[model samples]
Target: MKLGEPTLDQLHIFIAVAEHGSFGGAAKAMGRAVSAVSYGIAQLEAQLALSLFDREGSRRPVLTPEGEGLLAEARAVVDGVDALLAKARSLHAGQEPSLTLVIDVMVPGEVAARVLGNFRRMFPTCALTLRIEGLGAVAACLIEGGADLAIGGPVIGDHPALERQAVGELDLVPVAAPSHPLARPDVAPGESRRHLQLVLTDRSPLTEGREFSVLSPLTWRLGDLGAKHSLLKEGLGWGNMPLGMVAGDLASGALVELDLPEKPGAHYGLSALWRRDTRLGPAASWLVDAFRDGLGD
Candidate 1:
């Protein structure tokens, strides 16, 4: 005799019976009659052409070897169907199924972590992807359709194709290793021009010919902020760094804040960026507000 496919109801009854160890227990758990639970299992076994339970002499039902082997597979099917239903429900509620975000490297890691943790709790069903980029690369990701939203610096703030909202600001302070001449308290402000300054270079062409807060003509351009931090600690060059990133260095005397005549240090503004033509989904909107609240201080 050819076997037939099991129905979802039959699968549920099989799982319930296996879990409860008795037809009466399964019935109570499912809010059904004991006879109905037993009949459903009987039909399932007949369709599968297998003896799923060994109820010969035991007072409670017990799964046979075949039933034990197929239990995990049944659970997987049920779990997949449940996940499908959840995604459908999220869609019905106007939530995005997935979101991609790019953030500027200048944002404090602690701030990002705190906001993202809350996001996960608030939008458990929304899938999230994250990227960390420097300067214009953050905005480039959003403008090129690689990200749903971006938290970037001032470089892309005025782009006509993108809309933005101010999120927060970071204080960029010029710093150098304690051993560097620029760190000397009596060093004249104009003397910094003679030394090499470490400056962050943009990865994308969005800011190709433009420079921000660059004070020295003699400079070493670096693509990564971390590299600049490490170089500053090594006395290789002096550069402006976010206060949040180098606060410990200044406190410990590993690095010292430089007082330049031009006052290159300034507040770096951060903003959330997205394409002007698109409206944000629920999860993305929540994220923008969360970032603003987390970093607003």
Candidate 2:
């Protein structure tokens, strides 16, 4: 804001001149008069108290060591200004500055990948933050106002305040490493309870007393699906995993599916959740639609 400080327009011209290497060429490329381009650079140099170009006895202006350093800074300033303008335009068009999403591990990876890829293309200016949680933790994030949208299982407390729609369900299969005792086809229920079971524990208190699809009395609670998958692969324990997560393992014989009469194969449906009182902006709404469409596909 100082009297001699270089303006964004001047910086843009300076960058163009630096890139093109001559006043005449920069002017021609930018569709401006050479004199105007030259004057802008002169003013910028004077304001910054630095000689940006070596014009002595040369047809094309050459950048000095100092000029090279300042050129990078000038280009950065111009880009920042352009981005500021774009953000203002996005605000005027009702696009949110940022969107936060909390997704469950049970959500199909392919569905999430497809939706997120489309989202990036559709809303390049909108900042996105993604978090992966387990079961009730997904809805807890929405309830706590920590996320703008949630894609996961149902929550227990204060459900009325949450608006949600079913997107898709994941089929979970009981699996164990090939070396685990349960990997055998004829393993009995009594024998299964004696060994350890890997289970995904809820981080939120919403499902504190409730357990779903848990057959074994002895268990190890884990929050991350990847960790459970690793332990299962290492023959540490047996547990249910989404079919997609373990499909390759199942096929490769790294893991074997267990038939548990006590706990049949189960489905965990993903729900797109948001607060009922908050109105979604363009980016958030688009994400919801994208998730629904991806699930349908």
Candidate 3:
């Protein structure tokens, strides 16, 4: 006998029956008649040449081993189709299929979390990917189309292909463990230069040969801020960190604020940048607005 094609509607009915454990229950849940739900399942099993339900001895039909295996496959297929339809509908409404957001490590944690939470609720159908990078790497991602948005640093110098908007400034304070030599009250500029300064280095060549607020001759260049925080706490080196990130450390005496005579504390600007040519989708635009608004605080 020639096999028939199983329809999506049949699969939906099969899933409902498997989940509800009986045709009558599935019919009640789906607002269909019991006979219709049973017939759909029977047709599906016949098309696939499988005995899905065993009706020999049970009060309610129970799944055969074959039926148990097919149930999971049916649910996955149904869910895949649903997701495909959702993505299509989202595209039809001008939503992006996915967004790539690259953030500078300096961006305030609270602001990033609030904006991302809002983005998820506002654009449930769109996918989001996040990358955390420091300095020039943030701009490189935007320039190379590796990211849809960037929330970070001294944006790769005036590029015509990029657009930047001010977010807020992070207060970069030089700090060290209280036991570190530089934290002493009478530490001189020449004396401080001998101790290691943990400086965040950029891999992107955009800032090659450039250093920011580096006052020490002996230095350790790191790519991650978290690593710098850890090294500072270990009395390994002294470095600048965002005040928001180290406030607790400062207050708890785990780390002490350094008073470097050559370089005082500085405010580094956080900005939102994107490709000038590619217009942002509604979700991305909304996020940019949220970040700009948060800069007020």
Candidate 4:
């Protein structure tokens, strides 16, 4: 006789019986009759040509070695089917099946975490891919069709192919480690040009040959914001950082805020950006509002 493939329902029953430990328990959990549950398991075992449960001596049915071996695979099949059904439901409701979000590294981690936590609860079926980028890279991702949505800073301002909405602002303050020369009160604003500035380099060509708030010609261009932060803490260079990111360091004297003659700091405007021709999906729409509300507070 040829072997048969296990139906989804049979796999579910197999898992349910294994979890509840007996046919009666499985029946109560599944809202099926005990005899039906028993027959379903028997049918599954016969289809697979394996004895799933040993029902001989003990009052309760225990999983045979074969049953134990196949339990994980059965659960995986059931999970995959459930996910497929969920994706179908989301599609029917006009939700995006998946979204790719690129964010500027300047966005505070805590704020991102809170917004994403809410997103997970609101759209459990929508798969999310997250990328953290700096400068023009955020806008580049959206323009290149690599990202569905993005939260970016002023560098994205010149992109005409993208639509944007102001979400919030970040205060970029020049800071240096306490041990650095720039941290001294006597250091004049003009003297800042003598020291190396740890500037964030744009990975994309969108902002080539352009500078934003660059105070020093002597500079160390870093692609990663975290690396700049670490280098600043090590007294390797003086550079601007989001006030929210360096508040504790400023307070603890690990880093000192620079009193630059140019100005104390500038507010970097953050905007939610997406392709001009693409309509915002439900999850993406909700995310823009969430970022606005979360950052406003």
Task: Give candidate 4's error at residue 178 in angstroms.
Answer: 1.7
- Ranked by TM-score from best down, the candidates are 4, 2, 1, 3
**Alpha-carbon error at 120 in model 3, in Å?**
5.4
Model 3: which residue pairs collide?
none
Task: Flag regions of model 4 displaced more than 4 Å.
Answer: 117-124
Candidate 4 on 128-149: residue-level lDDT in tens? 9999999999999998999999
TM-score of each: 0.88, 0.88, 0.85, 0.91
Best by TM-score: 4
Candidate 2, overall lDDT?
A: 0.85
lDDT of the candidates, in the order given: 0.90, 0.85, 0.87, 0.92
Worst window of 10 by summed lDDT in candidate 4: 181-190
What would the per-residue lDDT of candidate 1 be over residues 1-297, giving only the tens digit for each residue? 888999888889899998988999999999999999999999989998999999999898889999999888888888788788888999999999999999899999999999999898888788899999999999899888999999999976699889999988999999999888888777776788889999999988888888877777998989889899999999998999999999999999999998777778999999999999999999999989998998886
Residues 1-297 of candidate 3: C-alpha lDDT, one tens digit per residue = 888889999999998888888899999999999999989988999899999989888868888999999899899999999989988998998889899999898888888898889888888788999999999989989888899998887746677889988777778898999988888886676777788889999888767888887777888999989899999999999889999999999999999998778775788888889999999898788888888887657
lDDT score at residue 252, model 2, on the 0-100 scale: 99
Give Cα distance to truth, residue 217, candidate 1, Å. Answer: 1.9
Mark the regions of model 2 whose C-alpha exceeds 4 Å error after superposition: 1-3, 108-124, 155-158, 187-191, 293-297
What C-alpha lDDT, on a 0 to 100 scale, does residue 75 get in candidate 3? 90
